[model samples]
Target: MTADHKIHKKDPHYQQAKRERYRARSAYKLLEIQKKFEIFKRAFYILDLGCAPGSWLQVSKKFAEDNLTKYKDQYYHRDHYVILGVDIKKVSKIENVQFLQNDFTKPEFHTHLESYFQTKIDLILSDASINKTGNNFSDHLRQINLCLKILELAEAHLKFKGSLVMKIFQGADFKKMFEKAKSVFRILKAFKPQSSKKTSNEIYLVGLQKK
Candidate 1:
């Protein structure tokens, strides 16, 4: 394999964007999905699940800027944006976003989220996945289970008409998962962003108008 081949084999857009902005490649995925779905515009309070590294928080903070940085860790103040990011893994410091280190699946997660927002969130996004074991079936199952838990959490914490975006693998439970999302959200669709590699099974599900 040549050097050029190896470089090109990686996600070209992701690499380019990351180099230019110093953000994770996953940032582009959220941006692409948001651009197509328009779920971020009206969001007042946002929750980012599995939010380590702060890419999703970066995207959301740009949307939630309110000019006053009330939260101590939240540094960027634009005028109306509020962002809360949580993950099991620790993340680097980010201005204009609040970071919480904890497992989101735990009940204690609500305490942090509620304190951050003081109310229900307008948008919830989970770009989380289990460590890939390289076994396609098991990986898919693990991802699906994670998505389900995030969905349940969203249903509990999100305000009416809020939106949710979750990353899930295309597999046996994909359809059932979509159906469950459809029941709670008025609009549900799966999108594969141009930035996402064609070979990856990862697909983003955008749920709008939470019921």
Candidate 2:
């Protein structure tokens, strides 16, 4: 392994995550986003796509429960909050979280979501990406496709004025993906958290107040 890779294996965030019993070190990324954007504010109903090992779900559940008694917002239909996680792989059970073992990029899955929530989502989180192939350009394009798929799902299920946070690889098509996201959200931002490795190309796209 390279020196940077070896250092990352011993990073403080990873150590903290293990000590806290979080599902993975990725939890810190979401915590940083929440600190910067307050995306969880008054957000009760949450959808976590590609949530395997359930790190994001763990964070979402914490925020959702906190929003339960937030005096209710006038612009949204959030009389209650539910957290649902979908991935092809199964995650160990987390209290109050429902896990679906199915591909979320399918019409059937979308249909199931409509029935399951019966209302719009307050926030959507996606840390999903294509498995890397070690070819930077190829991996970037693949991740861009996955982001497009996630954008479509967000459009269908997210509530009016809902928020979305998703990870994307920075590369040739990043600007194109960011612009596409702009068309869907009134406020769009590209944020990089300190917890991420310096060498990684990953950055998160935060879309707020979906239009």
Candidate 3:
């Protein structure tokens, strides 16, 4: 095998210390966004759509633990935090988090939600992506449809002043989706995480302060 060929096969983040510690390159994406947005502060209930192998779930658990620790002295009573993660694929295993394997586009998905929390969710996250057929237009359409369905479910579960963070591609009806999201949430932002490959079109849309 050529040395140049071997170089192309290496996973850049796999050799990095942080990736080894966290077990995922996607973990850095959440860390970076949380650093600036403070998305985890005082968060009580969070819903993770398409959470498999759970990098965001890990970050969220840490946040809840910190919140409990930080307020123990002042509040005298600890608040309970509920975290639920759902994906079409089964999640390996995670502590202090509920994992469900089901298609989010179906009605049964809502049943999973009803079975879990009685109250509204504070944050909703979806890194869900459709299997691409390599046709850009078709891929974008499928992804956009998935994103819209996620938004519908998110809107139903999210509490007043809650937030949603989702992955979207810049194509087809991306602009229209953004505008639609803005109508329901006070703030809308599009962010491309550093962990994402330069050649990829994945962009995270954050809808904050739900109305």
Which candidate wins on TM-score? 2
Highest-lDDT candidate: 2
Q: What ranges in model 1 sit over 4 Å off?
A: 1-11, 66-79
TM-score of each: 0.86, 0.92, 0.89
- Tell how far residue 139 is off in model 3, in angstroms: 0.9
What is the TM-score of candidate 1?
A: 0.86
lDDT for 131 in candidate 2 is: 96
Q: After superposition, how far is residue 116 of candidate 2 from its true place, in Å?
A: 1.3
Off by over 4 Å in 3: 1-12, 17-20, 72-78
Residue clash pairs of candidate 3: none
How many angstroms is residue 100 displaced in model 2 relative to the true structure, after the best TM-score fit?
0.3
lDDT of each: 0.82, 0.91, 0.81
Candidate closer to the true structure by lDDT (higher is better), 1 or 2: 2
lDDT of 1: 0.82
User: Which stretch of 10 consecutive residues in model 1 shows the poorest summed lDDT?
Assistant: 67-76
Q: Indicate the residue-level lDDT of 195 in model 2.
A: 93
lDDT of 3 by residue, 9-121 (tens): 57565446254566566777777777767777667788988888788888888887787777656543357788988887888778788888888799777777877888788
